[model samples]
Target: MDMVISNLQQQRAVTEQLRREAAIKRMLVSQAVADIVKFINEHEQDDCLLHGFTSQRINPFREKSSCTLI
Candidate 1:
């Protein structure tokens, strides 16, 4: 009877350790996902700025040719 009680206590300790490890792993994964989303949002804003600048630079050339015909 004493041996059985000791075995049960050991099993409970192991199960608690596994649960704590799983919780830590879940938190780490959630943080990584948040960081990735933040990076993508920043990159998209940078891309929009670059596109706008390029379009503005090309517009003057287009306007000059069109105005000569007017």
Candidate 2:
């Protein structure tokens, strides 16, 4: 049916648009990761990375949790 065909075409168009948006997001993430890699490489010899762990987990491997529960 003509209506069925039109619906299929519309779905395909929507899918293609979503694919394009996902591809763009992938590109942005790739670029961000590349920038982070470059930054880490540039700072590999410094103490910068160690202190850059999770917000307050500066010494990530330490036995005591930074926040003590009451």
Best by lDDT: 2
C-alpha lDDT score of every prediction, in listed order: 0.76, 0.79
Model 1, position 18: C-alpha lDDT score = 91
State how far residue 22 of model 1 sits from its true place (Å). Answer: 0.5
lDDT of candidate 1 over 28-60, digit per residue (tens): 878999999999888986664445645655454
Off by over 4 Å in 2: 26-70
Clashing pairs in 1: none
Shift in Å, residue 23, candidate 2: 0.4
What C-alpha lDDT does candidate 2 achieve relative to the native structure? 0.79
Cα error, candidate 2, residue 48 (Å):
38
